[model samples]
Target: MFKPAEGPVRLPSGQRYLGLDLGSKTIGLALSDTGHRIASPYQTLARKKFSADAAELQRIVAKEGVAALVLGLPVNMDGTEGPRCQATRAFARNISQLMPLPIALWDERMSTMAVQRMMTDEADLSRARRAELVDKLAASYILQSYLDWVGGQPT
Candidate 1:
């Protein structure tokens, strides 16, 4: 079965979905169960060489039974691709070689800021605490956005 970058993707129908919020220093993780109703934050991985990162990601995919991957695309404010977007695509291409899962790139313009704001207002967390959790929380945000869109919520 084939999966598109957006919309309803047809997979094997029994595997979980994985979401990745890739950053300069860390990669946030989120997982969706086979039913794809809810998405939960998983973990954050410190950035490293591509080989090492791919290995770690492979481990997560294996352990979580991930059928497809959702990658957050850091597009510019004007909705144009920039250097960061290029980097993300490069990373996606490289990872697709190691694991052939369908990859979807979701817009991630304000995901980090939204996560930080949520941490600050809802949790009343200190700056340091927010920084520590921002990546993984952003992953949750990304996954939630994708899920909402897939559920036919307005964009």
Candidate 2:
């Protein structure tokens, strides 16, 4: 189902969408319901390689009936794009070639830092536990933000 996209994905109702926090060594995953109202942490995929990661994600997308992707774009704080942003865009391009679904890049500035702060200050989690939860939690944060924006937009 790897369809090429012209731009960012426009999410439709009654279809699940997967959110991703793509790290160099791991990929965090979150899933929105058919209604696209609630998003929850789905999994943290350990990166072995691009093809393998995409294949696993493809399987999950098919299994979950996911209609699109919401990828966290790591933008810089000064409202400027940097190497990480460029790398993410390239990753999106490569992934777009592999999957037909639209990949929306959500501004993910401080998503990880926010997640870490929440885990440490609010959850009172240990460093090891925080390490385990941060990625997926960050993915959830990204998805939730996107869902809120989508809900706010006029139909």
Candidate 3:
């Protein structure tokens, strides 16, 4: 019953959204407040078998009362999709079969880089510390961006 979301995601009151940043070795997770105004870093899941990953996600969705998902879609600076985009889409398709929720693909160009820069320049975190936090923080940024966009949409 899961399908790609085409526009602003409308959620029921008291429900939340989950944001994801999929990497080769890990998947970063973020959660939105029930009001859908703020996104906070949740946790990072190490990449494993697809079934295991999806199961973990399902558990989070149920526990968090998540109503939908906002998954980062990495695109080139020139706005062209490449292998990474394809992989993300494939993951979405696979996960949808298991979880019935709307999935919005948000352009994630430079999201990681932006997070890295903020951690290094503003936070002044060591490389090890940044490495530990960047993925989840990037997920937060992606989710915040989506929420902001949704807020601006016509009611």
Candidate 4:
């Protein structure tokens, strides 16, 4: 399921790519449009045990007809891998074992910070609102970047 995407990925109609921004306490989810052109914030799942989390993700994948997963990889700003990155890699490996889908590990440096700044500077949301919105929004940002990257690839 964790096959390398050497070529452009094609999915069946009505299927989508699911983006995940994994946090210690919660996992934010974004769902790509069926056309694979846009991603939108879907929901936030509070983290439990790994098995429980995987079960919930599997449920969502089935419900949304997810074709693949784009998991945010929290690499350091210096382009170095760290414990967070290791944790993400492990999560991806575990999730892939649970589901049959190609997984893309997208660099997510500062994704949460970027979303925080947007909420503060542009949206002018209150602190509580920003806290409530940051996770899912970050997932969207990660997915959008992945989609843009794929778009830039030559057909």
Which candidate number has the best lDDT? 3
The lDDT per prediction is: 0.85, 0.87, 0.94, 0.88
Q: Tell me the spans in candidate 1 whose CA falls farther than 4 Å from its real position.
A: 1-7, 153-155
| Model 1 residue 153 distance off true place after TM-score fit, in angstroms | 8.4
> Tens digits of per-residue lDDT for model 1 on 49-141?
999999999999998899889889999999999999888899888888889888888999999998888888899999888878888889888
Per-residue lDDT of 63-133 in model 3, one digit per residue for the tens?
99998999999999999999999999999999988888899999999999999999989999999999999
Highest TM-score against the true fold, candidate:
3
- State, as a TM-score between 0 and 1, how close model 3 is to the true structure: 0.97
Misplaced by over 4 Å in model 3 are 1-3
Q: Which ten residues in a row have the lowest lDDT in candidate 2?
A: 1-10
Better of 2 and 3 by lDDT: 3
Q: Write the per-residue lDDT of candidate 4 for residues 79-142, one digit (tens) a residue.
A: 9999988899889878878887988888899899999999999999999999888899999999
Q: Which stretches of candidate 2 lie over 4 Å from their true place?
A: 1-10
Better-scoring candidate (TM-score), 1 or 3: 3
Candidate 4 regions exceeding 4 Å error are 1-13
Worst 10 residues of 3 by lDDT: 1-10
Pairs in steric clash, model 2: 1-100, 2-99, 2-100, 3-100
